[model samples]
Target: MTERVYYTSDALEMETDVVSCTRQEDGRFHVVLSATLFHPQGGGQPSDRGTINGVPLLQAIQDGHTLVHIMEGPVQPGKAHLLVDAEVRNLHTRYHSAGHIIGLAGEKFGWLGVKGNHKPGDGRIVFDALATPEPMTIEALATEIGALVQRSESRIITEAEGKRLVTWGTLKPYACGGTHVLNTAEIGDIRLIKMKEKKGQLSVQYELDA
Candidate 1:
């Protein structure tokens, strides 16, 4: 049987024991713990950066349904301290919120397949669609996402509920296991970084303020 994953609901520092860890066939280290604040990689969000008993975390990918933190170095389980790269996580959180704003805009504009996109680099996101949008003006996309982030709408819904909000015809609701800002406004200054067509698909990229 696979091990059970543990996590915390709050972001504050709290000690958690590393219960167990082992090597997998795919070369990624599998870890389990009494609790963790580190968010696993999923939903277009990269894994949390951190260390385990002095070992550096490279990335995280979900193992079936469990949250695993992939690390480099020796790690023995049993009450190991938990640490998280809060600065990186903060940026990821902003990117995630920005992704949602794009989803909302896609819906308002009758675009489909807008969710389920995350470009891995510098907190960028891509809103994909089966059909290309008429080349949008930067200010137009910015005003849509920026206003939402500025509004900072406060709503914490479950996976089922979140999916319900961004439902587009024939498009599945995205389900990601990453930490997100409480409101849209937390994702400030999202710019439309790109738009491209490949094999008839149009992808819209979001730019993060440096």
Candidate 2:
């Protein structure tokens, strides 16, 4: 397996690495680096978009053992320095952090168990719960998350089984590989755009203020 420069479950783990890299036929970079803060897109979370050595990375994806960075301009397949856009990284990290914050409603409201729910900015977080919100005024769930944002409490990060863990205000600790902000307050007033229930799954949609 190639070196995973960035591996903690921490989503906000941002850093830059410089090392030997290669350009693929499909127009992607085969990167072998010392260390990387950029996360390869996977697990339903969209791939990250940024630049490598000043060349814009079309996107990043994990292909088995290889972390590929698809780009536009030509790239050199040797040691090259790299930099990541802080803004892009932060946005992705914030969404990831918000995802966990949003899960609080289910965990607090009570859930039997939930699975297959991805981070926010992609879709809804749905799982088994003692109760799902009613069709009308389901927005209360979003309001609950808003309250957390209002509290602006710092979220603590830990490590378990090689994955970064985040915990907030008695909410269930979650294991994830994406980047995240330092605190729940950084989520910054997200708005739940929609809510739906289909085939016994509760789905809530939320977006950060732009």
* Best candidate (score: lDDT): 2
Residue 126 deviation, candidate 2, in Å?
2.2
The C-alpha RMSD in Å for every predicted model, in order, reads 5.0, 3.7
Which digits, one per residue and each the tens of the lDDT, describe model 2 over residues 116-192? 33344555566564655433345667677778777767766678787777676655677766666767777787777
- Looking at model 1, residue 120 earns an lDDT score of 38
List, in order, the clash count of every candidate structure: 5, 12
lDDT (Cα, 0-100) at 80 in candidate 2: 56
In order, the Cα lDDT scores of the candidates are 0.61, 0.63
Q: Which structure among the candidates has the greatest TM-score? A: 2
Q: State the displacement of the C-alpha of residue 78, model 1, in Å, after optimal TM-score superposition.
A: 1.3
Predicted structure 2, TM vs. truth: 0.78
